[model samples]
Target: MSEVYAARRTRLREYCNAGGSAAALVSRPANVRYLAGAAPHGAVLLLGKTEDILVCGPSADRPSQERPDEALRVQTLPGAAGGDPAVAAADLAQGQGADSLAVEEHHLTVARHRALGSVAPRLRLAGLGGAVEQLRVVKDEEEISCMRIGAEIADQALGELLESILVGRTERHLALELERRLVDHGADGPAFPTSVATGPNAGRPGHRPTDRRVEEGDFLSVCLGATYRGYRCEIGRTFVIGTAPADWQIELYDLVFAAQRAGRESLVPGAACRDVDRAARQVLDSAGYTEGLTALTGHGVGLEIDEDPQLSPAAMGKLDACVPVTVEPGVHLPGRGGVRIDDTLVVRPEADGGPELLTITTKELLAL
Candidate 1:
C-alpha cells in the first residue's frame, strides 16, 4: 500500500535528517524495493525532504504495480543505457532543494559516486551506511508470512526429492530438478543457487553442484530455499545414500545434529548473537572436530538469503523478537565427507512457544 511505503520513507527521512542530510539516494535494489515496492533494473530511490522519487534508466523494466504507490513518483532517464539512476537521482535531489544527500556507500560504486558528484557539484553527499539493512533485520508479520510460505515450498520440494529414486543421478540434475519443483510450488524462484553435494562434498557449505554421480554409500547433502514475493528461507539436510550409514557417518551426523540443536535453542530475545554461535561451536569444539566448522553456525535470512545479525564468533548484536535466522551447524571432514543440518526459525519470547521452526522437514539421519 502507498501508506506503508510512505511510513517507511518517513522513518528514513527522519534518519537522514538526523544525520545532517536532507535526502538519501538508495541504489541497492533491496533497499529500493523495501521503500518503493519495486526496483526495476538500474533503478534507485531518492528520499527527498518533500517527495520520494524512483529514478531508472531507459532500458529498465517498468514496475508491475498497475497503480503505482502515490507516495512514490517514477522518473526515467532518456536514451538506452542512458545514465546511472543514482546520478539521475542526485540531479533530481539538487533540483528539489536538497542541500545534502546521503548515499549507501556500501552499495554505490566509486565510479557511480564520482558521477553523482560530477552532475550535482553543489550537493554534499554523505554515507547512509547500513541504515536500510538495519531496518530490514526485524521482520514484520507480512514479511514473515512470505518467508513462511517459502519455507513450506522448500520443505515440499525436499520431501518430494526424498521419495524418488537416487541411485545414479548426477548432482546437477538433482539441483536443477529441485529448482524446477520450487517454481512448480508457487515460488518466484530459488532464493539462491541450489546446492546438492554428494560424498566428499557433503556438508561443504555452498558447494556447487557438479557432474559427480551419487554413489551407493556416500553422504548426500542438499541445501535449498525458495523466494516468495521477495522473501527467502533456507533449508539443508544430509542423508546417507545406502540402506544404512557407516559408523563414521552416524557419529558425524549425531554431532552436527546436536550442535545445530544447541544453536536453535539459544535463539531468544536479548540473547547475544555470538553467544548463540558459541553454544553450537562448543559442541564440536568439545569433540575435537572444530577445525572444519563454518565460520558462523548460521545467519539472518530475509529479502536476501544472507542479510544481517550474523551468528558467528566475531558478530556483535543481540537477537530481537521477530528476527528470523538460520541455525546451521555443520562439520566437513576433508576426504571422508561430513554432515550439516540447517533450519529457518523466528525468534519469539519464551511464553509464545520460543523460537518458531519454519522448516518442518525431519532432521533425522535418514538412510536412503
Candidate 2:
C-alpha cells in the first residue's frame, strides 16, 4: 500500500512537471487521501521540488488507519493558521524554491485561494484542473477488492432488512436501521445517507427519508451503500409491500429491470460513457416513460460515493477497464409509486468475462 501511494504521487509529480510546475498542492480531502494514505482533518498534500509532504493542521488527528504513507514527510502546523493547511503547504513549497505551484482550483474557495497566494507571493499559482481526479478514474485490483467487500456488506445489510418485517415501518426508521446494519456488518460506515422511499416517494433518486409508513401494495424503494476501507459501493432495490404486486407494479419493475440490465451490459471497456446511459435510457424512452427521468442513468463510485466516468447522456469519455460505476434506472408516476433497480459493477474486457458485479442482492421485485 505504501508503494502504491508512492507510485501515485510519482505519477502526479510527472504530471506537474509536464505542466511546468515544480510543486502541487492537493487540498481536496479525497485527492489528499488518494496521494497520502489518509486525509487527516484539515490536511493538505504538498508535492514539493525537494520532497512530498503531508501537511496537517494542529486540530488534525492522525488515526492509525488514517496515517499517511511512511515515504512522505508529515508537517504539523501550529495555532490559528493551522486551520488552512493549503496555505501552510504553499508557504513550504515557496521555501523549497518552487517557482510555480499547481493547485485544485475547483476545490479551493476564493478566500482560500487568496490566502495561498498571500502566503507565497513569489510562487506562480496554476490550476491543477482535475488532474488528480483523472488519475483516480480507474481502479487497481486492491481498490476493487475493497469496493467488493463494501458491496457484500451492503448486500448483507439489505438482505437482512428484507427478511425482517417491513410493514408499518416508517421510511426514516428503515433508513436508520439499514445504516446501523451496515456498521454492524463490518462497514466503516454508510457510504451515503440510506434512502428509503415508500408509496409515492418510491423510485425518486436522492429522495430523503420521510415519516411515511409502509402500506400494502406500495412500492418500496431503497438506495444504500457501505464504505469499507475508504472504498464505497452502491446498491438499490425496489420491492412490493405486503400483498402481491399489481399488474402496474410488475410492469414498472420489469421495465426498470430491463433498463438497468441494458446499462450494465453496456459497461464494456472502450464503450462510450454516453452510450451506456443511452442504452438504459432508450428502454424507458421506448416505453413512452421518458418524462421525469433522472439527468444521469448512472455514475462512477469509489472513495467517494460519486466519482468519474459518469454514465450520462452528456458525459464524455470512454469506459476503462476496472472503472467501477453504478447502473441505476427508474421511473415514478406522479401520485403513484414506481420502481428502481441499481447495481455497482466494474468495467472489464470481453475476455475478462465482461463487467464484474459487486452487489449481488436480487433485483427481483420481492414482496415484503
Candidate 3:
C-alpha cells in the first residue's frame, strides 16, 4: 500500500516540475491521502527540490497508519502541538533554498495563505489548482476495488429491504434501517445522505428522509451508497408500494429507466460530460416531462461522493478510461412522484469492455 502511495507522489512531483514549481504543499485531506497514503490531522505534504517531506503538527503520530514513509521524509512542527503545519513547511522549504512553492488555493483558506507568506517571504507562492485532483480522476485498480465493494454493500442493504415488509413503515425509518444494514454488512460509512422518498417526494434528488408512511399505491424512491476505504459508490431504485402499479406509474418508470440506461451506456472513454447528460435528458424531454430535472445526470465518484467530471448540460471535458463516475437521471413533477435509476461505472476503452459497471442491481421496476 505504501509503495502505491509512493508511486502516486512521484507522479505528483512530476506534475509540480511541469508547472515550474520546485516545491508543492498539499493540504486538502483527500489530496494529502492521495500523496501520503494517510492524512493525519494538520498534516501537509511538501514536495521540496532536494527531498520531499510530509510535514505535520507535533500532535501528528508519524507513520502510525498507511501513510508513505519511503518516498518522503517526515517532519514535525516545533514548540506547539496545533500550529499551522503549512507555515512550518514553507519556512523549512525556504531554508532548503526552494524559490517557489505551489499550494492548493481552492482548499486553503485566505488566512492560511497569508500566514505562509509571512513565514517565508522569499518563497514565491503558486496556485497548484486541481493538479492533484486531475491526477486522481483516473482510478487505479485498488481504488476501483474499494468502490466495487462499497457498491456491493449498498446492494446487499437494498436487497434486504425488499425482502421485509415495507407497508406502513415510515420513510425515515426505512432509510435509517438501510443505513444500519450498510454498516452491519461492513462499510466505512454512508457515502452521502441516505434518501428515502415516498409518493410525491419520490424521484427527487437529494431528498431528505421524512415521516411519510408507505401507502398502498405510491412510488418509493431510494438513493444510497457506502464508503469503503475512502472510496464511495451510489445506487438508486424506484419501487411501487402495492402489489400492482398504475399505468402512469409504469410509464414514468420505463421512461426514467431508459434514460438512465442511455446515460450509463454513454460512459465510454472520451465522451463529453454534457453528451452523457444530453443522452438521458433527451428521453425525458421528448416525453414532455423535463420541467423539474436535476442539473447533473452524473458525476465522478471515488474519494469523495461528488468530485470532478460533472455530467451536466453546461459541463465540459471528455471522460478518460479508468475514471469511476455515477450515472443518475430523474424527474420530479410538482404534484406527482417520478422515477430514478442510478449506478456507478468506470469509463473504459471499448476494447476492454467499455464502461465497467460497478453496481450490478437489476434495472427492472419492481412492485412490492
Candidate 4:
C-alpha cells in the first residue's frame, strides 16, 4: 500500500514536471486521500521536488482507519487553530526551493489561491486542472476490490431491509434503519444519504426520505450505497407494496429495467460516454417519457459517489476498462410516481465477461 501511494505521487510528480511545475499542491479532500492514502481535516498534499509532504492543520489528526502512507512525510502547521493547510503547503514548497507549484484550481477558492501566492510570492503557481481526477478515472485491482466490498455491504444492507417489515414504516424511518444496517455490516458509512421514497415520491432521483408512511398498493423505491475503505458504490430498486403490481407499474418498471440494462451493456472499453447514456435514455425517450427524466442516465463512482465520465448526452469522454460507473435511469411522473433501477458496474472487455456488475441485489421488480 505504501508502494501504491508512492507510485501515485510519482505519477502526479511526472505530470507536474511535464507541465513545468516543480511541485503540486492537492487541497481537495478526495484528491488528497488519493495521493496520501488519508486526508486529515483541512489537510493538503504537497508533492514537492525535495519530498512529498502531507500538511495538516493544527487540530487535524489522522483518522484511525485511514493512516497516511509511511513513505510520505507528515507535517502539522505551527499554530493553535484555524489556518489553511494549502497556504502552509505553499510556504513549505517555496522553502524546499520549488520554483513553481501546480495547484487544483477547480477545488481552490480565489481567496485561498491569493493567500497561497501571498505566502510564496517568488514561487510560480500553475493550474493542475483535473490531472489527479483523470488519473483516478481507471481503478487498479486493489481500488476495485474496495468498491466491490462496498457494493457487497450495500447489497447486504438493502437485502436485510427487504426481509424486514416495510409497510407502516415512514420513509425517513426506513432510511435511517438502512444506514444503521450499512454500518453494522462493516461499512465506514453510507456512501450517500439512503433514499427511501414511498407512493408518489418513488422514482425521483435523489429524493430525500420523507415522513410519508408506506401503504398497500404503493410504489416503494430505495437508493442506497455503502462506503468501505473510502470507496463508494450505489444500488437502487423499486418494489410494489403488499400487492401485485398493476399493469402500468409493470410497464414502467420493465421500461426502466430495459433502459438500465442497455446502459449497463454499453459499458465497454472505448465506448463513448454519451453513447452509453443514449443507449439507456433512448429507451425512455421513445416511450414519450423524456419530459421528467434526469439529465444523466449514469455516472462514475469511486472515492466519491459521483465521479468522472458522466453518462449524459452532453458528456464528452470514452469509457475505459476498469472504470466503475452507475447506470441509473428513471422517469418520474408528476403525481403518479415512476420506477428507477440502478446498479454499480465495472467496465471490462467482452473477453473478461463484459461489464462486471458489483451491486448484486435483485433487479427483478418484486412485490414486497
RMSD of each: 1.4, 1.0, 2.1, 0.9
As for candidate 3, its clashing pairs are none
TM-score for all models, in order of appearance: 0.98, 0.98, 0.94, 0.98
Compose the digit string of candidate 3's lDDT tens values, residues 90-202.
99889889899999999989999999999999999999999999989999999999999999999999999999999899999999999999999989879988999999999
Highest lDDT against the true fold, candidate: 4
Per residue, candidate 2 scores C-alpha lDDT tens digits across 1-368 of 79999999999999999999999999998899999999998899999999999999988875445668999999888866546788889999999999999999999999999999998999999999999999999999999999999999999999999999998999999999999999999998999999999999999889999999999989999999999888999999999987688999998899999999999998898999999999999999999998999988999999899999788889999999999999999998988978889899999998999999999998877988
Q: How far is 106's C-alpha from truth in model 1 (Å)? A: 0.4
Which 10 consecutive residues of model 1 have the lowest summed lDDT? 62-71
Off by over 4 Å in 3: 58-70, 76-81
Give per-residue CA lDDT, model 4, range 1-368, as digits (tens). Answer: 99999988889899989999999999999999999999998999999989889999988875578999998899988776678899999999999999999999999999999999999999999999999999999999999999999999999999999999988999999999999999999999999999999999999999999899999989999999999999999999999998699999999999999999999988999999999999999999999887978988999999999999899999998999999999999988878888989999999999999999999998899998
In Å, residue 74's CA in model 1 sits off its true spot by: 0.8
Q: Give the TM-score of candidate 2.
A: 0.98
Q: Supply candidate 1's per-residue lDDT for 317.
A: 83
Backbone clash numbers for all candidates listed: 0, 0, 0, 0
